[model samples]
Target: MSGDDKYILVAQIGGAFGVKGEVKITAYTADAQALKAYSPLLDAKGQPALTIISARPDKHGLVAKVKELATKEEADAARGRKLYIHRDQLPEPDEDEFYLTDLVGLEGRDADDKVIGKVKSVQNFGADDMLEITPAEGGPTWYLPFTKAATPEIKPAEGWLRIIRPVETSERDAD
Candidate 1:
């Protein structure tokens, strides 16, 4: 399949482990360890492909050795390089479940049919998912919660999302 046909993304890569060219990986898959099974990871440009020789748990990620990398220096050079697999390699998720990548480029709108912005990206900083929307006319980007109440409709086919505006509260009534 062509590179564009692939939907997988490189999650994370670790620094060189030992002189034998072993590195670490942190996959975003539900079963992180299963990433090694996907083997033959592609680079961002889809030029170089890497094969996982062995992968085992080490601290927060899985330590792995890739074919063709026979020295610590080579492994160190690959540090921070993301490994990508074909999107088809991943199992299908149930309906109502969406990947963050699928949300990108989706249109954002309010209840009154007014255009709000376009989804640039989705960010998660521990608590909840945040939708980063960039306005059409160069306005400041807005971060809105991607909750059921805030985002009632998400039509991926239409590439649009309907969001409810947040209600602001005044502090004066607290006194």
Candidate 2:
């Protein structure tokens, strides 16, 4: 697959651990320990990038030894690098279930079934997933909370995203 092929965010490198090459990692996988199973994790460019030789659970995350890293300084230098897996590496989603990566490129439609935009990407800035939409009429993109109410229906198989307009809130509304 090309570098632009879909890649799923699985984990992120944290600070170095101990004096060895081991580094702490924050895994986004459902089973944290399962991170090692996805060997040779890919980087943003879709290249085989990392291998976890071993890992142990820590209070904050996982302390992992990387195959390519042999010193604390090496691990520290790799901190903040995101780890991913090719989309094809994942098992098929169960019925009515979908990976966030599947949301990209789907049509974003309003409640009235009008094409408002296209899904550019799915993002999470620590709170929750947000859908980045490229407007159909060609303006700067905007983000919509990927909540059940805001995106009530998302049929990835059918290339559709049903959007419900969010209620406008003001400072007064928070009073």
lDDT scores in order = 0.78, 0.87
- Residue 128 in model 1: lDDT: 92
Tens digits of per-residue lDDT for model 2, 32-114? 88778888888888877789898899765689888888899999899999998877888899999998889999999997899
- Number of backbone-clashing residue pairs for each candidate, in the order shown: 0, 0
Which segments of candidate 1 are over 4 A away from where they belong? 1-6, 125-127, 167-175
Candidate 2 wrong stretches, greater than 4 Å: 1-4, 169-175
lDDT of 1: 0.78
TM-score of each: 0.79, 0.90
Residues 29-48 of candidate 1: C-alpha lDDT, one tens digit per residue: 66767777777777776654
Worst window of 10 by summed lDDT in candidate 1:
1-10
